[model samples]
Target: MELAVRAPTSATVDDVEDVLEKKKQWILETLYGLVEQDDPPLDKEYLSSEKLLYNGRRYRLRVEESSVIEPELIFDGNRFDLLVPENDAINTRRKRQAVVDWYVTEATQKLPKRADDYIQKLGIDDIEIEVTTLQRRWGEYRPGHVSLHSRLILAPRKIQDYVVAHELAHFRHEEHSDAFWNTVGTLVPDYRERREWLRVKGSTLTV
Candidate 1:
């Protein structure tokens, strides 16, 4: 990533110096245009373009230009990575299984083996971990199981740990009630701030 800096100029008008404020804006616009032209177009046809591991299961990506307004994952017998166009609401559902399957293998190698340890510390048990891609939630704890979005791999390590701890707390308390929060606090005292940070910056995780 390159940044363009513009020098300010001074011009006297009515004994007042006119600062060249617009130069900075112009330079930034020029840099953005150049970057756009130089960057390669986003390949929307390659399925399994990127891989991520949540828990232990490997997920393959499927990219397509569809009418769906938002990017989403489809699990229709097989996982499908779906990318929709904002303007071109096309119905193209091209499927690519594993163009880059190595990503899953690599990501799995990076996952922690003792993912449930943190929850166990809080006296919770009988919870399973599942890795998936969810647009809105980072982690969820259902009855006897927990689903963690594979996108969490994009988050910082501390934040990811916070998410894990949060879900684990749910095993004891199902809702976001006071009891649930107190349980989370026992594991991660600053979980609220980390949760807020993930909410605000979650979009940055996507490629």
Candidate 2:
């Protein structure tokens, strides 16, 4: 971790030293917290023994070699069977990307239908839904478009539904006011529970 401090242009070295001296405890605590983090997904190496969370269930990965075509990842309700192209090197980053591609493809197939279900239920039309990687947010909504984070496929099915409902609710009310939450509740009565689940476990949803 790099430490950077921004002070007023006219500030002296002594001023900066005094400020850092005062808040040293808070800074150390923050740095130590980051250093001690052990989030499995964030540190995934994509090895065969390393497991992945799909639809909120844990499954170990099994790698195999195939010469005919491209790499393919298959889910058989028990494990992830990945068929790597025989000529390609099964390096960590490549395997991780294969897993990420699988998640994006699965999200492409699944999220649209779920969003459409809510769309039909809410009688909202003309809102385009997209699946892609997002730097921070799980779902985004504008006037006529919504983009869902591809990594959201790692979440439970109910949580996925909540994200869709949350974005669709924005079609009616763009802000998180009571009226907006009421609309979301109308669409998904148990959204609060799913939202809570995300708050507690969402950070682990990574490739």
Candidate 3:
């Protein structure tokens, strides 16, 4: 998070300034990279044609509002069909929540199936999976339970599997020692690529 420059004692002020100007592109890229790690959540108005991610694929959201109908969301393979109350035209929060809630609900139903695959592979049992909002990490592990960020459901299947494997590896090794990484590798050999993708793009996984 720190950026510094060095200059010889004999160098004039203009020389240092010139150095900064010459390297401005690099300095800006470096700063932008740092900011991207914790980039702000993706902002949306929940309107038609907007992009929504699920299982690592971008699908256009089609919003339909009605006065007498209940607000609901449906995924029909091609895109999301969002049915909302007529007031959603002026009040977007409710429409947005419908989408968020759908993701959590879907995550609860589907994500656990993936976790079960790994659990069997790792030969573990009685592990509960909770999909909820996680602030700082993609996944966290305790002794007998695994909590995944609901947003993680937005990632591709491989990426999601890597995270699950990562947390499950902690079961065998609490600390991130060499044995832990070796275990992770067994589950996800390309974890480096998946981890890097999440690091750079995790912030964008939002409704």
Candidate 4:
């Protein structure tokens, strides 16, 4: 971005600092240009000069006066750079896995007691809770196990309970028939509202 500056009359250091803060992008770009230039034979000498003036304010320009040095990117001669690129696929996968692990750990600690209570109240038997990250469903029930998506951690407590109850209902009905709806409604009368909330907010629960 270009910053247009008018002539300044007796501008102070504070005025230059203020303008620099406001035109940061322009200053950085100017600094980068100086760093990339070959004519200066860049040494340790760095300096800032007033490049322009606008509205009685001095627009200061920063010159690296030396090759750009990012300490984080420096490496021993024998070692390669370890910084992960933002767009790298493997880095993305690792970030997602880390999020899943965190959700699973938190949910396992928070949900077990609630799961046991609901199971007993519903008279369900031989059910195990397994937490995993899923793309679509919040909870699913097999013959003897309940698979809960790690995304459930993002839901409010009432909605989480509704999901657990919904799956528990599935243990008895096996399908989303009227009987299953009735069972879920018996446990959580606001099931429809909770389900709608999940549908609307599910996308925001990303890692």
Candidate 5:
């Protein structure tokens, strides 16, 4: 099987490589299981026939091979028209990277804004927001910063919003204590449902 590591900018190559080394067995096992089950709808293969999710909407990818200068992605609410260089069109790994790059760009632009809004509502102004790659978590929070996963861009807006609030709530309590959960509930009344949704479908959302 093929393996690719799209790590956070702050991570060094060595650090990413170390993580991959540690998780190689787990990764191989997961991939084998997914392959056996035929996988969820969108397995991030980046094939033209695969379905993609954007803000809770399902879209099928339609690749238009062209002898153009660069790859281009266009979404007209129904489908993703990915115009790729003829050479890149047939390269599955390259196509996957292109689609993931688009998702990262969108996440960088939109996720931070959503987090900022939640930060304001939480009345916390000292926290910094950054879009990064997190393989095992949707968002991670520290004393002064929060790193949101770029993969979140594919989920619905409400789910994304819930994650922001959940992270922001961390500032009030370091652990997932009752107080911290209360803070999240105050910010998002239906957070339980959102958490449930993530528990059920989060595994299928991968790069």
Candidate 6:
């Protein structure tokens, strides 16, 4: 097997190899899983022809360079029409930033209400709902606030609910003990399946 590793420019060759050696088994398993995957991996290129999943439905992307200074995203029940400034059309970083800004705006509008419903159902008070550009986890709960990965808006509603419930459960139990799982199960009866879906497809939930 051929493995290509990219690390910080400052890192030594031994440092890179040591890290790869430590996670060799995991890397192999991930590669095997990619090979076995039936569905085409979600596009991370953020290009015009890319297919994007939003709220459980697929939307084809259409990028239009417009005179408008601010980027705008419109979904016409069929696909996403992204109107961007002409300068942003060819710049990957600017284009990605525009798309991510839209996603973050969407999550800010939708997720808090959904979280509020669960919070009310669980009788949890004084819970602050916020969106974050989280790289490692879906969501996390602190003493009085829950921070969700903003990109979760790309996932289906049920999956989003599972994440919200999972964090809320943390409000009661700080650790993932039986009591914690049971609490999560009580709120989301089919959580096991939902979690499995995230495990399989979550990596593709990128913008």
Q: Which 10 successive residues of model 1 have the least lDDT summed?
A: 28-37
Best by TM-score: 3
Arrange candidates by TM-score, descending: 3, 2, 5, 6, 4, 1
User: What is the C-alpha lDDT profile of model 5 across 8-67, one tens digit per residue?
Assistant: 899998999899878865763353122222245544656578777888777998888887
Backbone clashes under 3 angstroms, per model: 2, 0, 0, 4, 0, 0
lDDT of 2 at 155: 80
Residue lDDT tens for model 4, 36-64? 22232222211234222111122343322
lDDT of 2 by residue, 134-163 (tens): 755788788999989887788888888988
Per-residue lDDT over 30-135 for candidate 1, one digit per residue giving the tens place of the 0 to 100 score:
3212122223324445444565333224457566666665454554434645554556644434222232232334334443333656855866566667776554
Sort order, lDDT high to low: 2, 3, 6, 5, 4, 1
lDDT, residue 151, model 1: 54
- The sequence of per-residue lDDT tens digits that candidate 6 reaches over residues 110-175 is 987777767877888988889987655788778898998887898899999988998898889886
* 1 or 2, greater by TM-score: 2
Question: Per-residue lDDT for 134 in model 3?
Answer: 70
TM agreement with the true structure for every prediction: 0.49, 0.76, 0.78, 0.51, 0.75, 0.74
- Write out the backbone clash pairs for model 1: 48-61, 62-81
Please tell me which model should have the higher lDDT, number 3 or number 4: 3
Which residue ranges in model 3 land beyond 4 Å of their true spot? 1-35, 38-42, 67-70, 86-90
Cα TM-score of candidate 1: 0.49
Residue pairs with clashing backbones, model 4? 5-53, 5-54, 6-53, 6-54
Q: After superposition, how far is residue 69 of candidate 4 from its true place, in Å?
A: 25
Q: Which pairs in model 6 have colliding backbones?
A: none
Candidate 2 RMSD to the real structure: 9.1
Q: For model 6, what is the C-alpha lDDT against the true structure?
A: 0.77
